[model samples]
Structures are given as structure tokens and as C-alpha cells.
Target: MKNFILALIVGLLVSACSIQRSAITGDKRAYGYSWEQEKQIGKEADEQIKQHFGVYDNVALQQYVNKIGQEMLAVSHMQREDTPATYKDTEFFFRLLDSPVVNAFALPGGYIYVTRGLLSHLDNEAQLAVVLGHEIGHVAARHASQRAFIQQMSQIALVGGAIAGQHFLGIPGGDLLGIGGMAAQVIFLSYSREDERESDRLGVEYASMQRYKSAEGAQFFVSLERMSAQSGQSIPNWQSTHPDPAERATSIPELAEEWRAIGYEQTIVNTDQYMGMLNNMIYGDNPREGFTRSGTYYHPEMKFQFSYPEGWHVINQRSLVAVVNNDQNAVSIMTLDNESAGAEASVNVFLNQDGITTTGKSGITNRGLQAFQAEATGQTQDGVALKFYLYSIEYDGMIYRFINYTTVDNYGTYGPRFKEITSGFRQLTDSGILNIQPVRLQAVKTTRSGTFRSFLPANLENLVINVTPEDIAIMNQVGLDERIESGTWIKIPR
Candidate 1:
């Protein structure tokens, strides 16, 4: 019995040691996720990510970005011969997410993502390399695993309050926690400020080692700062999960100078190559998925239209579309349920859910669409009381559900608005709205020297890209008053 007890203790110690040493940064006090476990976690999270935000649908651009990412990874920390076999064997995936939100991030086990929004903002290839390297650094340093371990150790319950915290942190699945449950939020958890700083450091190191002019990466941060200021946001959504852009812009150039001091003379900054790649890139939101115009939500592919409450905020995610009142005391969500054969079946499913108390008669909507409406009260898993008006309508061969909910106390005030929106749903038949294309960036050469604003075409705002001279200045990495030399190439939205 004594010998068996000793053996058990020895095995436990070995396991703990393995977990500590698994960190790619060689920190023995790091998290408990083994390389294999990290990979598994990333794999599962990657699927959820793909489901929530699809891959950007450009094959050639995807390949081009992947080629650059592959080159960077070959020189990253994980690619070293001294890296642990488990970690070294893990394959890194670079994906361009189809989101208009400018952002770049990574998941555990070598999964890295950059949004097309982020790509469109980049000024040069070296900046792109630095961004990719920063995300890779997060994966290599086991930051997400560390965060998961911290969450586990802290036993942070991902309830409504926690979901709100995640939302304010700018991670995905903020409002989605209530819709799809907590699984979606888990995969998109944010990193700590320290983790972001370390990744930034790693980014400079890796990009500089690859002989890229890493200082050019600072221009992206400048754009971020300008964007935040323009939006009147104290911190941009992307920076909420990462670090302060102003701080990053200040420090990145200094870090680049240090890297250059190591005797690397021929650093490459392929600005023309990068700008040419982004010449026709989509600038802002893609209307193909869904878009709002004159307070109405239109889905071109789904061929449906609905009016949301005026002044309400809307979040259009891939999995769902949601609108919440300015007070945030009420929310209206739209989703599809293909499994339900008809409207009555969809209503029945909602009524059958646990804790739901159906309080009104369910019947057809006023428009003669196969539909039913029900007033229901329910409690979330956290036991928060909720009042809901659920509308299930069968439209275009699918069951479309409109769930409007509020706290029990606020239901009376929000009920009329909810009813108005739910009743406003109908099939769309407008060809012009359906065929509208997204705004794209057009690279044009300067005909004569002038201020940046002078080069902008008169109908810039009327086009899909709604931006100002200040925005154009930031994109071109020049001042608004800076004179443009003749024949200089610049990007203008068209």
C-alpha cells in the first residue's frame, strides 16, 4: 500500500510538471493545458468561430494571405527546433473572417484569424506580417490556454453578468450567450492586457527577424486611434479585447528601432504590393448578408424585410440578427428554424420549453401569413425573470421567428414597440435594394499635387464608402494637409 501511494504521488507530480512546461514561452508557472489539449480546444472553438463568422469568400486573397502567414510562422517561436514535439507538431491555420469589424485575434492551439476589415486597413506587407505575427505570438505563448485556466481556477460562471462583461470586453458572443448559450462565448474569450503586450513584443521580434520593416505596423495603430476618435468611443471594439491603440502606436516604433539595432539593414516594406492587393477590396459592411436602410432591415438573399424600432441599436451576426432598445432593457431577435414545418409548430416548440408560462392565445398574424403570436414569461438558467412576445411566421419556405423580450418590470413599456416591429414583417420585392453591391476601394494615381481632400471625388459619400477627409488621411498614412506628389498612387473609395 505504501509503494502504491508513492507511485500515485509520482504520477500526479509528473502530470503537473508537464502542464507547466507546455507553455511555448518556456514559462514553468503557466497554465495547465497540454499541447494536445490546447489543440483540441482550438479545434472545437474554430468550428464555433466558423459557424458564427464565416471565412471571407475570396479564394485568391485567402491564398495570398496564407502564403505570407506561412512565411512568418516558419520563423516564429513555435517553429524552433527546441520547441516541444507536441507543440511543434501542431498545425497553424490562418483564416480571414468575413466581418466588417476591424480586428485580428487568435485561439489556442495555433488558430489565428484576421478580418477582411483589418486587411483593408493595412498599408503595407510588413504591417500585415506584424499583425499576423502578433496573433501567432498569442497562440505560441499559450495566452488563450492561460486565460482558460484562469477562468477555470476562478470558477467564473458565464451567466448574464459574465456575458455582459464579455460584451463590454468586445469579444464575440456577447448577446449571443443568451441565444446560442455559453459555448459561443467560451471560444471568443478575451486576453489580459499583459498577454496583449507580450504578443505585441513577439510580433515586433518575429517580423523584424523576417527582415520586414516592422515600424510600418505602427500605421495601423494610428488608423485605429483615428477610428476610435471618429466613433466617439473611448476604446475601439477591437482594442477592447487587445490593448490601447494610442499606447501601441507610441511603443511600437520604439520596439522596431530596438529590433533594427541588431544590425539588420535591408528590411523590406512592400507598400505597392500590399496596396495593389487591396485595390478592389470591399470597404465597409457587405449588404449581401443583411443591411439596414431608413430604419428597415432587409435581407437580400432571404428576400424578407422588417422594420425595427427607431433609435434601437442593431447587431447583425452571422448566426442571428438582434436589435435592442437604447436603454438595453428590451431586445428583439430574429432567427430561422428550418426544423419546424410550420408557424404553429414553431410556436408550440417555444411554448414547450421549460419554465415558459404561455399567457395568451396563439393565433394567425393579421397579414394572412401562416403565423402565431404568444405572450410568454420565463426564467433564464440564472433565474432572471423575462417576459416575451414570440412571433413565428412561415415565409419563403422557412420558419422565421421574432422573439422580443424584456425584464418583467419593463415589458409594459416595450410591448407596443415589439408588437409594431413584429407586425411590420413582410416579403421584399424591390430589385434595386436587392442588387445593391458593397462599396469597394479603388486605387487611383494622383493627376496633380494637392491636399488629400482635393483628390477625393465629389460623390465619395454617395457611394458605398462613407468616410471623411480625416479617414482618407489615416488610410494613406499621411496628414490631411500633406501635399500629394504628382503620379502618387492613393486609395479612394468607390
Candidate 2:
């Protein structure tokens, strides 16, 4: 198959380059997809990207992501001026965030953010290209704008807007007003099965054209499915945006068949290199951005800390953090709202994201507090179901507690974990936590080290380097024919 595709595509390479030359394409794709539409949609969706996940800042990581992104654009059908690529005019930005959410998101202006969690999961550059291209397809197809346009087209936006303005005065501009605790409920309200499937197909084709085997790219999703089942958590972001994994699983193999018939090969999964990039890339969460430690939650900037039950898992995403107990029953998170005068204003800002009512003398308390709970009566779009409890409690001018979610239809596999985490929420004591700075690898020379093994103690502690067979190879290049040196600056493993 590889030999056949290699020979056959020799002639059609240029033809594939002009895939966007025609205004009308095929039923094989979502009709009326144009460059202009993609840009318009990207404009709106970009706002959502900012509102949801802010830009991730890291220089070396960003440069590499853009280089790959540019290569993808050179091979894709997104450059027609009238049908200008979604980010043609914009500078493409890519960076790794210090997050464990395992996500990759694209903003309107070619702003792309990939989490270290997701980076740790990918195998190679080709696989990364496929995922990045799929996101580009979303921008190209105007999915985000289409969804928002459709939302406005329907009465949902109006009713949602009125509800948003009336109760949640602390609502910010643009969409996603109450996004934190309402993810599971509001997700399916966006795209359809057909739209996502089309994106998948096109994504593969784009990858194929770029000479990055789409087959391996498809495997990332497969690996994710297995990882999610093993972790018993909801299928992370790989399949989160696009649901129906079992069916999608079948589709990828089918597409592989299509590419096989037309000549597509698979890329190798380089787990070693992948993990190396993740090493010291900042694990779990950045404590600086408000995460809890020990039995207490602290926000040094927000100037407060909350206590939690022991043995609970804590999650700290930007804007909020929550602790769940072992029973899959309760959770406590945090938020900040400065709109309502005094406590009422803060509480109003916190509840505004979900259209919750913040009226009539809302007071601050500890145990019994203001919160919202959502029950998933049936299955979610991805078929791995969940239920969620969301709310905010405050102390000393700071408001905290968003939601703790659990799996329901899926036999509560992730549910028990969720409960244990949420149940840990409590008030803070006067005790403070000591800070420790994490050591990261710099592109500096080997300041002091006898050997790779000696530098890495038995316990490893803050040591991030992994003497992989490849690193050993690079080490050989040191001070010989090239500038590679003892500490000639390379990324260390997480």
C-alpha cells in the first residue's frame, strides 16, 4: 500500500494542492465551506477561545508549533483569498500551557494553545500536525461561527441572553458566560455528528497531503479512548469536542482504507521523544495560578485559603479550582466576581457564568452555601455520561467553589473520584504553605555534572533529564563535529 500510494500520488500532488479552486466540491464534505466563512467564524470563535482558555506562553514551544502549522498551511486547501485561510492574515501563535487538561485549542487570529498534558500524549511531529490540522479544519469550516450563528439563528441565544443578563449581572462580554460548571450540559448544544465526522475526514486528508501520515494521527484518538477507559475518567479533550468514539473509531479505519486505496502510510509513534518534551514541562498545575496544597487551598494573589477533607483529589484550572472527596457525593471550588457591591457582587460574578440567580441579599457563609447542581438524566454526546454540582461559597472578600462532576450512566467510574474530591472542601485554617520553585532545563552548558547517571540520583528529586538512547546519541555529537555540548541546552523530561 505504501509503495502504491507513493507511485500514484506523484501525478496528483499538484491537483490536490488546488483542492479549493472550485466553489462547489463534493457531498463528501460539508457544502458551502469557504475561506471567508471560516474567517468570519474564526473571528467569533477566537473570542470564545480567549474567554475559555487564555494564551499559553512559552517561546521554544511556540516557535516549533508555528513552524509545523505553516508547513500544514502550505499543503492544505485553505489559502484561497476570497476563501482566505482562517488565519491567513493573522500570525500563528503556539505555546504549551502548564495544564493537565490534555487539550489543544485555536483562536481566531491563528492563536493555538496546546496543554503539556496533550503534548505528553502525542507520539511525533506528524501526529501533532494531524491534530493541529483538524483544529484548522474547524476554523476553515467555520464551525465555531456556524454554531454561534446557528445559536443566534435559533431562539436559544435570545433566551440564553435574557437569562444571562437578568440573573448574572457579573457576566463578561461575548459567549461562554457561565462555562465552568456547565460544560457537560452545554457541549452537545454545539455541532452535529455529521459536521465532526467531516472534520475528521478532511483532517486526515490534509495530513496526508502534508506527507505526515494521517493514520498515525488517527491513532492518537484510539490511544486516548484506551487511556480514558483505563483512567475511568471522561475521554479527555482528544474526543471531547468530537463525540461518538466507537463510530469514529470505525470511520478512521475506513478512512485509512480510503487513503490506503489512494496511497497513505502511517507515522511512527515516538513515545520517547514525546515524553522527553513533557519532562519538566510543568506537571499537574502551576501553584502560582491558584491551586491547593496539602489539606488547604491557597490563592496568594487572591489573598485567601480554604481547607479541604483529607484524601480528596484537587483540580485547579484557570479561574477556578475544586476538591472532591472519595464518596462521589460533594465538591467545593472557587471563583472571583467583583461586580456586586461587597459579597453580593462577588457571588453574582461567580454565578453569572451559568445563568444562576444572584438576587436578594446573598450572604457569605462556610458549610451551607450558595451553589448549583446539574443532573444528567441520560447519556452525554460522547456516550460516556456524567452529572455535575456547581456553586460558590465565600470568605473574607474572596468567593470560591464552582462544581464537582461525576459519571452516572458510565457506572460512575469517574464518579467516585469526583465525589471524593468535592467532599474535601472546607474552610481554611491560619497555617500557611511554604513555596518551592520547580527546576526547569535551560539551553545552558553543562555547568556541573560528572555523568548523566550521577546527575540523576536514585530518587531523581528535581532532576528532569532522561538518558534515552537518543540523548546518548546527541551526547556523542557534543564538542566533536557540532556545537552540541554537555549542557548545550535541550528540553528535559517531565
Candidate 3:
């Protein structure tokens, strides 16, 4: 998220004189950044995105998505004959993020990303084409640049922090310590309703040109609608911005029909191929990164464990884990200091920051690990006074820093809770917790024709956390009572 912070700051610092013609309509329009500047911004943001949400590790799946994206691009406005020369040859980058959120989005330039969670919900390649085409439409239409033109830069910054707080800390304006940047930008990049509708039209047009069954795209929206209704909230990264999944479910087919009337023969629906690609794919949360149980957090991969106060929320990402208080005023963060050689060296970096005044510093030991502890007071960028209790532990040749902080006025109330959590940090030793594996999609062929529910294992809950027959049905794009033919491949969590 720090990269997101830098991206926002860099965006704010850009010159405002830049303007450019629309890539899709060829009409002269005002833009926040020149076309060349957009490319540079996207290149910088792309690096941060990869770091924030690690690329999905499957090489074959990555190539498959890229191939589809390139095909969609060929038919998009960016590649059309009327497109300006400056944009006609813009290279597009399509990436599958390892995150489990159902989302697909485009950066200001030609950077596009789809999450593994979205892939898990898709039933066919044509649906994927439409999703990729939808994102490509955003880039082709210069939606982000247009938004930047109409929005106040300061408002965008506030929106970034608000999204980070809400998503990570479960509070609308909670200040998440270290995990606030690029990921927040993802939610911050949500388009207007008009932009979304335009993207939908462009998506159908591009997918239709490629002869995909563009109408199949509607089914994915149906899945999204069901997911939203079941969760009682919009799906993260997607529905948050692209609202009205149920409404889109109706319009998508109408758009496809419009294309058919124009002589586009949409017929492709590579279900088997898509299903084959999904076999053995990871589903739900990847617990190897970290998981919480009975108030203790454990990282099997990192081989560490810690305890947070009961009722505090935990947001665990590939880079770090943040624990937030119920009131969202206090936060404790844990992250690696890869560059620092030892605990004391890491502590120095924290103490040297501007506006920070150290009140106490000492060498200490925690759970048999060498560590340095420090107490400091400082004011935030917004001039909010705060107190900090920091720790840097050296264990197995790596420095793990725990940053605990709260508003100066509330420090007395939450200070003990912070100390208790950091002091509880220890090496993970339980064999069962260390060996837990992530649930994965198992592509199973039905032995006999039956309702989709009948094909699921009786111990469905045991196979995956918080999953149900209805959830699996929605994932397979079928109904719980729908009869599934024998020998047909369907995904089951295992």
C-alpha cells in the first residue's frame, strides 16, 4: 500500500496543463495527463500492483489470460482504424493477481488485472473474454484519465485512505498503518455509472468481434448477483464500483443481441477448456500466508505466531498483517525489515523519522529472540498527535518489526493492549497448524445424473471454510436443484 501512497502523491504533483483527445471517439477532450504521461503512470503503478497483489503462480493460466486479452485488444477501440496514432500501438499488460477477491480492473494506461477469485467464478472462456474486454474498454476509453480530469486531486487522496480504512480495518476512516497504498487505489479507481455502461457496451462489441458468446457474460453477472445477495454486501474489488450486477445480467444479453443484428456470429463458449484450466486451482483464503483462530494469528509459511486482543480485527496480506482495535482508533502492524541487518539497526530507522521524539529505548528479549524496544511520540501528516510503542525482533537472520500506535489522548487506554500483542509473538511450533493447506477447486465429473446438490460431498463444510451447497451452485453457474448430466465436469471444493 505504500506504493499506492507514492502513486497518489506523484499524481498530485503532476502538471495540470496536459490534455488529450479521446482514444475511442477521436473527439477533443480535456484530460489530466497527456497520453505519454498516462503510459508512464501506468508503468509505475503496474510495479506497485504486482508487489501488492502477487501474480498468480500458474504460468499456463497466465499465458491463457494474456492470449485472450491480446485478442480482445485487437478488436478494442485502441486498435481500431479510427484510433489516433499515439494510442493505436499502445501495448497492454494483462495480469492475474493472486488475490481471492472477485475483481477485474484497468489502470490509466493499458494495464489490466483479473483476480484468481474472479477466475474461479467464471464458467467459460467467452465469459472471461467479456470480463477482459470490459477492462480493456476502460483503457480504450481513457476512463481513469477522464475521472482525474473531473475529480479534485485532494478528494481522490481522501477516497484512497477511506477505502483502505474501510476494507482493512472495518472502519470507514480508520488509519491503517502500513497497508494503505496500491490496494486502496484499486477501489479508488471505480468508474461512474455512465463509464460502466459504456464499458459494458464496448466489452460486448469487442468480444462479439472475436466471435465469443458474448451473452455468456451475463451468466457471470448472475453469479456475482447471487454472491452479493448471499454476502449482504457487494463483492470486494468489483461490485463496490461496478454496481448493479443483477441489472447488468439483463442488459448484457441485450447488448449481445444488438451485435448479432449487426452480423456478428457469436458462438464460442469453451467451457471444457476453461474448466480444465481451473482444475486444482486454489480457492478461498490461502491460509499459508496467515490465519487466525481463538485470538491467535499464525503464519505457517513464515513460521511465526502472535496473539491480538479479543475483538480486534485482522487484515492479513502477502506483505504484512495489521490488527485494528474495535473502535478503529488504534492499530498494530507487523512487517519484515529485509534491508536492516538486526533489531537495533531496524529500530534506528524508525527513531530517525522526522517529527518523532524518542522517550525511551532499550534492548530486550521476547520469547527467546533478541529485540529492541522504543517509545516515541509524533504528529501525523494531518497533525494528529500520536504515541508509538515499537519493537524490532531479530530471529533466524531476519528482522521482524512490530509497530503499535494510537492517538496521543488514547495511548493510556490502548497502550497495555499493544504491549500484550507484540510480547505474545513467538515461533509457530504446532504441527497441525503448520501443515494446514488451502482449499482448492477439484474438477469432478458426475457419475450419475442428479441435482447439483447431490453431487456435492456430504461433508461440504469440512472441505472448505464458510462454503455451502448454494455457494458451489452459484460458482458452477447452476441451481442447487438443477439436474446436472452425468460425465459433466463441475467444480467441488476439496
- The CA lDDT of each predicted structure is 0.77, 0.49, 0.84
| lDDT score, candidate 1 | 0.77
Q: Which regions of candidate 3 are displaced past 4 Å?
A: 1-17, 153-159, 164-187, 240-243
Query: Which clashing pairs does model 3 show?
Result: 1-181, 4-182
- Higher-TM-score candidate of 1 and 3: 3
| C-alpha TM-scores of all predictions | 0.88, 0.54, 0.92
Which candidate leads in TM-score? 3
357-386 in candidate 2: lDDT tens per residue?
A: 323333334356443323232223455444
Compose the digit string of candidate 3's lDDT tens values, residues 205-230: 99999999999999999998889899
Output the lDDT of residue 472, model 1: 69
Candidate 1, RMSD to the unseen true structure: 4.9
Ranking by TM-score: 3, 1, 2
Which residue runs does candidate 1 get wrong by more than 4 Å? 1-18, 22-27, 158-188, 235-237, 240-243, 365-368
**Quick one: how many clashes does candidate 2 have?**
33
